[model samples]
Target: MDYSKLLSKTVVDLKPSGIRKFFDMLSGLDDVVALTVGQPDFATPWHVRETGIISLERGYTYYTSNAGTVPLRRELSAYMKRRFGLSYDPMTEITVTVGGSEAIDLAIRAIIEPGDEVIIPEPSFVCYEPITRLCGGVPVPVATLPENDFKLTAAQLSAAITPRTKLLVLPYPNNPTGAIMTAEELLPLCDVLKNTGVAVLSDEIYSELTYGVRHTSIAALPGMAERCIVVNGFSKAYAMTGWRLGFVCAPPEITKQMLKIHQYAIMCAPTTSQLAAVEALKNGDGDIEMMRAEYDRRRKYIVEELDRIGLPCFEPKGAFYVFPYVGAFGMSSETFCERLLNEGRVAIVPGTAFGKGGEGYARISYAYSVKHITEAIERIEKFLKTL
Candidate 1:
């Protein structure tokens, strides 16, 4: 029982995910509507699923190349260039991992040394901070304000940088907040980064889900591409989360180191999933549009309804989540979500799960059907009345 001495302090010291704290309590509860998970409500496109089935039928079940299947990587390279104005050499610059989560880990591990600083924008995804810490990198969380639509401004980026800074995580079309950064917005940040050696890890997993405009990648900026690692996956856009497919596109120099860790840790991403992803990259543009249209409808409806209900939610132009300020109810985000689940039977994540900047806010995902979203809104309205 003296395992404490043998265990890595880093692992022990790492906190559990804040998003799961309340979700774990919903076990065995009936009639509870959970908007906690960020997975797409739609099924994986039939063509993409069919490819995986066909691959299995054809006995294409062996491990892929550590960098992933060449055809898949080629398709991913082309997809990235065409969709996001970012280019990469498929053979040498891209590595398919288990999911976007692995891509995050791989990129951080490759670039960071002990005591190296990585700037993270909060009220964003949950993994960047913990993953950076796991790699012995110090995480400098920059608060993304509601007024700026939760984007990491050039001023914030400039403030967080020092000589020891090694990386900045650019999480846009952001999770929890759903804020997007247009190219105009990114140009100033690019100016700040031009002469600096600070590398950027741009997580564009939700790139395809933008409502009013296309997702912008900092890598597309001139000179910025040399300093950016782009992480994307089939999970959010292609609705293939369970298949667990993702990739990282960076300079060959960085990819070389990342592939080393990935080689020893994970020989390759799943064979079936890689095959399926190829189909998604090649022919799934239409599927993305169809799903984005539905999400846009739901996004608009939920934002309007929440504001109408006096929650004063900021309109989100990207991703499927709507974050409404809940401090007016005189409760912390945790207390608000706890009470809503107990009384209204609706499960939304407390914004604090994302980071400190997320306090007094709650993340409500609109990935559900309109009917389901409407019902949740009604329940939320009733809960607010009781306040």
Candidate 2:
């Protein structure tokens, strides 16, 4: 009769996502200018959607190969090289996953042993540490600071590692903080990583949305191609979140192991999404450019407005979220977000939902319309006046 005793302790102890609770609260409110989740407001590019439509109309709905359609994988390989200078063999080094979340799970489950440590930078995507724990690995969080623009320094990484560190999660163009690692910024960390027998799980889903600087994949660094798994998807850049598609790229040995877990657990990725992904890679660059321009405009406007409202915000260089420090008002991040939603009727995620490093901050997604974001900012200003 005791459910707690019957369930796996790991699953029982895992906390549900903090982002969703705010989303659920906002869903019931009327006239709310909400920006809690990172769901991109842009429509999925027509060409990509049309391909999915055509596939469905033609009844091309059979399951894809365990690794995914060869055509799609080939296009992904080409896209990686074109966008980020990363190289991989489509047939042997990439496996299409249900989404980037699954790729993280597959990568962690494939490599980590029971006591292995997974070094994750705090203020990171929420899934990494949880998935690591579920896979029986220890989650070691290294706090990335606002003073350093939230980028994990070489000293932090050096200190986090031990003989048992099996992996390092590199989530740049990061979700909550929107911090990015440039090639220059990554050099010394790469130096530190070079000596350790650790694999890098690079999450670059926002790679296509960077403003001025192109994203540099750790996989492309010298000797890194052999020791990295790059996890990415159509969710953010292409506004294809509903498609439920993503992929991972690694060396053949790692790919082979991850592919096995993916095969047994997932069988294959969705067929329609696979076909559409091929179209996306081939013809979606223009769409990415258009969306990126709009996001850049909104990103700038939001940062300026937050400062004018007396909330200091970090000018995020990538992704569509801005992290603003909310501690000066003498409230915790959770209380700030809760009060903001109930009083201001504008929903934004608390940064501590990400990790402890996010204690004094709140994450505001700018993926909504400019008018919508502007309105949210106006309401937020009035809320602060009340505080």
Total clashing pairs for each candidate: 0, 0
How far off is residue 21 in model 1, in Å? 1.0
Give candidate 2's TM-score: 0.98
**Tens-digit lDDT string for candidate 2 (118-221):** 99998988898888888789999998999999999999999999999999999998999989999999989999999889999999888888989999998888
lDDT, candidate 1, at 310: 88
lDDT for predicted candidate 2 compared with the true structure: 0.90
TM-score of 1: 0.98
lDDT of 1 at 283: 89
Q: In model 1, where do residues sit more than 4 Å from their true spots? A: none
What TM-score does each of the candidates earn?
Answer: 0.98, 0.98
Model 1 gets an lDDT of 0.91
What is the per-residue lDDT of model 1 for residues 10-128, given as tens digits with 9 covering 90 to 100?
A: 98999899887877878767788887779999999999999999999999999988999999999998998899888899988999999999999999999998899999999889898
